[model samples]
Target: MTYVFNPTYQLLVLASAFAAVHLLASGRTFIFASHTILFAALTAVLVSHGIEPYQTTAQAPGGLWVKLFYGAAKATWWIGGALMLVSSVRLFLIFEGRPREGRLVQDLLAGLIYTGAALSIVAYVFNVPVGTLIATSGVIAVILGLALQSTLSDVFSGVALNLGRPYSVGDWIILDTGVQGRVVETNWRATHLLNGTNDLVVIPNSTLAKSQLVNQSSPDETHGVTLTVRVITSRSPTQIQQVFSTILLGGRHTLREPAPLVTMGEMDGQSIGVELAFRVADAGQIITAKNEMLDLIFRHLKAEGLALATSVPNLGVPLNITSIGSAAADPSDQHDAIRDVPLFAALTENELNLLTQGVTRKTYARGTEIIHQGEKSGALMVVTRGVVIVEKELGNSRIELNRLSPGDFFGERGLLMGAEEPGFIRALSQVSVLEITSEDLSKILHARPDLADDLGATLAARLDAEAEYGVATPSMRRPLTIAHRIRHLFQL
Candidate 1:
């Protein structure tokens, strides 16, 4: 017997079968079971109709039923294709991996699946062969691959970079191009960096693969830095060592183990330059540690009457002499002077006694202003007991030029030629000064013209060197702003 097939019924059967297959592939138990039930019902109906279109003649009794079955099958295929496309999109979103929530993967999968499904649907509707459409797609794919070779390479490279985890977002990296910045985002085509200036930079994935990159913030977030200082040649090696050790110990931010190291970096004719090497948890904290260390060192040196060198204009001949001051009677002062000040030890007892007589002693409490800029110079000050801060007032702000200690001296140039003070001098600690009166200094110059001339020339040279290549004082160095401080703390 011949059976007639209906086109609409056939289409529904095909659609049900396709949907069942799709549900199974997606591993959705409830959907798969439902599709299975629908497929079974269609299969039963097709069988009960006795529609054997493949075996019957072209003009059969159940031709309409056969057509319906075929139509159903076609409809089922389309439904399955749509379900598969949806599953692909869901997978792209749900998959837990690097470049989380990346749009590239989702776009690529959707494009491929939708294009293939849509083409197949159109071909079916027009009675075109599936083989012909697939062949055309293959040819198009080859041409597209060749045309987009560089773009494809970058896409693949981005995948590799993400999987390799060479660096991650918020990490500090130094690229081969010498660009250093924090990673902000990574995509299929490029990676974004937030630079030191807070500017965003987009770098191609291909460039990243070809260039070298240093992940400074990878493996760990903390790093290290260094600080250096210079003291007068008159300062004893032992005293300088002690001062630096004290600074490192007192500093709140410096690391302890593998403790901070102090080394004498250089010996300029009249000064010993020292470098302090220390470890800090973050590069951001380096400035804070440096400031704290400076303050501590200055205060200690002042309380001890150490003298630091100066770099400024000389007002005059600066009394042409060094005074022993009241600290001359203190054994510690005598020991420090003899050990640190070469010029003092170089003189004979009579000369030393005369030099000591010219020196007058003075004390200043902490925060007291010792000398104001523009004031007339009387005697040069040699710090024999405490600390003094040399500052220059610039409009609304006071710029600290340097800190002085026991061996540090100031006012020589101003006293010699009798010029006005070039800046202000304040005490950071209780300061003990050895003051030399201009009258006594004149007498010493007359008695020992050679000594007076040599000392004056040395002081002048020191002043010149300071002005030429002066180190930045604590206040002169820029401080980290609030935004930078927050970023450093959270590593955002």
Candidate 2:
């Protein structure tokens, strides 16, 4: 052990110690520059001690035995140095932005570099004939190639794939054999994939190179998703199209540029199939997107009184349901709907009657825009029947904010403070709404000044909640300073 401190061995021993410490500290054993320096230092120390490193025959400690030990040491040193140099170069290139080399290329290059260095060490350090080594290697190669035919095929195929650069890591690919996953790693033997179930799948590179693959992330992150549903043939095609379009447009991750397509498909028995096609954020989001679309479709259809024909035979007579939103809501029903709203809860019976009479009842069919984002609206819409989707248009895509059902109200800020609409409100079904305008609210406030405080508190609380969730509108911010704004808007 004291030999480690000798002048001839100090550099080699110190480098070895440093390399071991770096491996332990960093946990990065593949960083080969330190290993390369250690090996080169070992080679220099061994050469300085003796000329010949290996012996063909046995001898005393000072003669043949010493030569043989040094020869073996020299070979190991040179071979390790060559391997480390190759690895270091590959890692440097990778970090320097030449990612085309990848793992397969790095492994192949390392193997070839080490093999050549080993051959040179045999010929130069040990004085073996090159011709004999070549002849022997040729026979060994054939035997190894025959034994590892499948593995060799994978290696060559992996090289071809890396060079051709089809699908890279992080790409979502579906194989011809129905395997769909995101590419996590590509090596000489297999490519690793992370599937929807969070399981890792290892596929041979040879199989992937031969099979057809669809890379949903290649052209861009945008991916098209198609949903099919069967509807009763009794429903009008135009209304069905409108219903499906509204549902698609209201989807959270749905894109609006390509405009969703709703085409009538084949007829099946008593029902007709319709396709709702839309593009979402990416392949990874398709599952959640599909789930959202189905949920919306079920809710919207139920609200519109449309349903898929039952497989069970019905003895009852089929009622012919016609155009949606055609029936006008009765005044009494509108009055009842307004009375249910929490905002109008504080008003007296006479005040409520005045509001009910003053309110304008509007009907909108499916896909109708009841209110658009940024539009000036001084009226509060109370959903009397059916569903309305509140969404915000973000560039070319639309994200659903909330859904409104019967008894739910929106645009209170607009009615009280004269604020602009924060988002778009579209009818998802045959919808009826009772609208209470700013003028009607002002008339009530003039007669009853105490109601302004209740309204102001409610508005302030809603705005604060929206701001906390990062969805606060610019127009709604003014109402958050409740004292002055509410008094001024309501004329209190």
Candidate 3:
């Protein structure tokens, strides 16, 4: 090892050490950095030892055995230099932007570099004629190219796609051939996509190159959704527009910048037509946004005493939540909303009416703060119209905890346990709610003791949800602890 320090062997020893480090760094981030160092060391060693890898008649230095070792070392040095060239191309890609999309170009360049290095080794080390070799290889290339015509087309098409960057990995694309999916991988021959059903789809680059494609994530990630709704003449056109406007404002899954739109269409003797057009964050959010908007439509319509046209077509759009909000809610809207409440699903008809009687209806416009974070409210509130978003602040970031629609409940923690809210609740649109004071809710809990069991479990779940969103709460005793608290608070 001490010989490494001797001037005669120092350059060789340093080159060998750099090569070892480069090999050790393979498959890691340090490989590219280490490759550069090894390349420089190899170049220095070859130049110092009077061995030129590029010179066809370059002598290997010393005796036969030493010449043999020098030949191998010179070949290794050429390969190292090729790798350094490849590394520079990759570094250029990082600076050029779109490192991910430029991978195909980088790889193709690396292959060419290695090929050139191989040709150089043949001429310089073996003293072979490259002109004859190039001529013979041209004939073989034509034959292979003809045999693998389709594959070659795909390879070239992939190169074109990477250079043009029509779509990158993670973009949702739809081919004219009716194939729609998110791009998960792209290789030499094909683009792999993960479809909505979680199935992997591989399409040859040749086909993708020819087929017309719509990139849903292009220009931006936001995608538009259009829904047509028909309403009976029971409500005015102005009223319908106002309610639909509220839906867009309250939508949590939709984008805000592009701004949602509502257009009044032709009206017939049976009903009036309206189109609700909005843009969601992405194609993946379309269904969620639709469902939430539909629910809000029903709740708002029911609260405002508007009804869907009797002749409204099914249109293949499945209405998931049924049996409660289907009919027009006018004379007893509060009673029906209370009946549909999941928390009071098991309550007697008379009990529901009793709770409904005590509720004081309240309303708020868009952007109004309904419940402030850390505020203690002595009343229980149930949403009767529109939507509200619950948001919590954690240091510098503010996260939306949840969105509440009609019939959903809140303020239980304050009313039952007299605790502060885990987050602030703000009205996303024109909102209306039925507020039940502690005195009113207490009477109902005392009247129906069985309700204590259900409300307690529901309240515990609500608190648990808040705890998950950067808030702290006690280890709630699912139903029992909450029920006991209700009894103590209300003196039941």
By TM-score rank, best first, the candidates go 3, 2, 1
Compose the digit string of candidate 1's lDDT tens values, residues 302-352. Answer: 445444544333774222222223335343453344334444545666665
Assess every candidate by TM-score: 0.42, 0.61, 0.83
> What is the alpha-carbon RMSD of candidate 2 to the true structure?
8.7
Best by TM-score: 3
Better of 1 and 3 by TM-score: 3
Quote model 2's TM-score: 0.61
Total clashes, candidate 3? 0
Candidate 2 lDDT over residue span 92-172, tens digit each: 646225464376777777788877887778776667887798997898999999999999999899999987878888889
Off by over 4 Å in 3: 1-23, 26-29, 58-67, 95-97, 310-328, 363-373, 387-403, 422-431, 439-492
True-structure RMSD, every candidate: 18.6, 8.7, 5.0
**Clashes found in each candidate (C-alpha, N, C closer than 3 A):** 54, 2, 0
